[model samples]
Target: MGVCFSTIKVSGSNSNNNVNHNRKEATKQQTKTTKATAPTRKKQEVVDHQQNNKNVNNEEEKKLKVKEKQGSKAIPCGKRTDFGYDKDFGMRYTIGKLLGHGQFGYTYVATDKANGDRVAVKRIEKNKMILPIAVEDVKREVKILRELTGHENVVQFYNALEDDSYVYIVMELCEGGELLDRILSKKDSRYTEKDAAVVVRQMLKVAAQCHLHGLVHRDMKPENFLFKSTKEDTPLKATDFGLSDFIKPGRKFQDIVGSAYYVAPEVLKRKSGPESDVWSIGVITYILLCGRRPFWDKTEDGIFKEVLKNKPDFRRKPWPTISTSARDFVNKLLVKDPRARLTAAQALSHPWVREGGSASEIPIDISVLSNMRQFVKYSRLKQFALRALASTINEEELADLKDQFDAIDVDKNGAISLEEMRQVVFSLSNL
Candidate 1:
């Protein structure tokens, strides 16, 4: 994520170097279903496998078939080239201009000579190449990106390749422009409440997806978010999943990773999980409304400390006035305890996020739930088998899922049913 954005200035943008709103200033804001849901399930719909062309190789079927760079029968681990590019799918593209460099990677625009298509290529250097300390950082990022899927709000990956030189990830190219550049350049850039709500809600939508996948995008900020107001194609794909991590069941991460301005408190002590991402969401929320970071300072160490220690003084906020729901939503995510924080899905339900649902959440009408890649990978042969076995359960079969959630009474006192389970699944779907 590029926190240090260029200050060249732009027309019709947000104002300032930092936001003046305090945590107290954000007062308010305030999912799921039975059956497997399409990412954008507003109501009910069934997959008519037999009614559709399930026999022939259709275009939609092909897209649904996830061609993992690692899973292709022709591109198995052993057969893959030294750079891991499949010989069957050789490098038929010429590398184009260097787009830009981030903390650990460089992006380039490339031309695929094979199809005459243009694509964005991200190259990641091994962390150990620089220093031992950077290893964890690199792993945190790669692991999270690879683990997450099926979310319209998060970044999408076309492929991951391992070469002697570096790890190359191919992704959709976003040309709109970085929010940071606009934020820095505009003298009076005030994102309207509707725009702010939509952006935050969309972000939370992605964040919610991450939580469901058991991963944490530890870094959340405007810089990490890519916006494309210029183009009429796609708005933007969330960029930079390097600081992400998959927190296992009944577990959390102990690495303090992410940008200082958006770091969550639990992150400072190297112990965090879904809540850490929520904290970053809060920081981004502050920036979108106030047109500046919630916390700002000169020194990196000082900024880190501020994230850990101080709270924003609402009186210091530059805005003449702010909404009550907005303040409430920020407070929910900024909570110090990980467990106390609102889940991303819940955040979406907040009034601040839903107030402008038309402009923000539903504008693009994206729903990662229906992602073909997800159904191909996650709803694979194994999942089919598991669900099949689950159907055959007597009294004992209920124990497995119940055991997964110890929240229910051991004696089954609490009537937490599959309905509740499905709700939780959607709430944490972004994970």
Candidate 2:
């Protein structure tokens, strides 16, 4: 995720609109170097900027103004203005605050003066689109979004307009923030199985729609899932088609792109298809059910190592409480073999999804409560290994937690510190 620019009022005189737009374009590009990347996967997709834009001061503006800037056409405002604010996008959209930015451009929550509707405008500065591949990626993103218009679970692409300095993309505003933020913000840090089912169903619906339209969203993660509105049951719409591409039937993509936590095993192996997105949904399902990541590790390498070799932790505290159908659903999609994994349509038809997991009012299990109490006491590394071990444990060995400890001590670093034990004991007493 990119930095979210704080909302600033742009209700000033329209005299400096072109200068302000250019300043924003330059600020967004300068901030590109700040994008976070995996240590091992240095070449990940150039993500867009975060929400909200800060107004640049005059001195900074002078220093940062685009050197070879050309267009400064003023947009005609008022009710009769053409769509997307006539030809000059700056005139129509008074960029209020920077919403977010990416390698290609910045996203702003712009006000459409003519309609009074809030629209998210992604500004892809032509000056920064230096390489052919980068330019093509932007084109592909626009093309995919255009083709997938009117999808219920995908972001609505209203218009894509370009001037000499920037390509402006107007899209439906998702006011509810990322699905990841929603999950993590919960007090218990978890969604009910029924809620998970609803979320996963929406995600799968988008995935199915994309596949049906001959496209593949190479990157599918919680951050990409945004709520359509602030309503309680507002649909989660998938956004960010930067890493997406058109795929013909039977074609396999070899690009290893995607956020580490939700990437599929086949992607790590350099072969991926629509099933890869299914695998990501499985990861999201696990997180939705439990607050924790299934194959988490401190480092990207450690995470990838687990993704390549480890099964998701189904025997862990939360899993023990999770319904059997829910477990089966996740297990089907997280299969190590892509061929064995469930497709989006198939996963959508799973019993748990069909029934909407456990009912919303259902209570979580005591075992899950107890395990979560003890689980949080462990060091990050130990917790990581324990979760990984939990997935591999069979039902027959459920009673003896100790029996699985040695198996999880993969590096033979077996000593549990007295301080750690004391912390666990103290946590248990409080529980």
Which candidate wins on lDDT? 2
Provide C-alpha RMSD values for all models, in order.
Answer: 37.4, 28.8
RMSD of 1: 37.4
Over the stretch 1-431, how does candidate 2's per-residue lDDT look in tens digits?
Answer: 12222222344345366456756776786666454335324443222111112234554566556432312111211111222323777667778788766545789998888889999999876645433455667777888989988988888998877776677889999988888555444566344667668888999999999889888897898778899887877889999998888887888876568877888888877678888888898988877776567888888778989999988877767667677878888889899898888888888888788653443546555343344344334434664676577668653344234334444434333333334566667878998
lDDT of each: 0.59, 0.71
Please write out the lDDT profile of model 1 over residues 1-431, one tens digit for every residue: 02213331332255343222221232221012322354445332334444355555576666657654214432322223244343322365566799777545688987676778777788765522333334445545555666654456556566666555466677666666665444333344333556567667777877877878887777776666776445423454577876666778878676556766788888777567787777888877766555455666777678877777787645544433566666777778777777888988888888777754432222111121122223234324754676577558743344345445545433332234445677677768968
For each candidate in turn, the TM-score is 0.57, 0.64
Off by over 4 Å in 2: 1-86, 184-191, 355-360, 365-431
Could you tell me the lDDT of residue 177 within candidate 2? 83
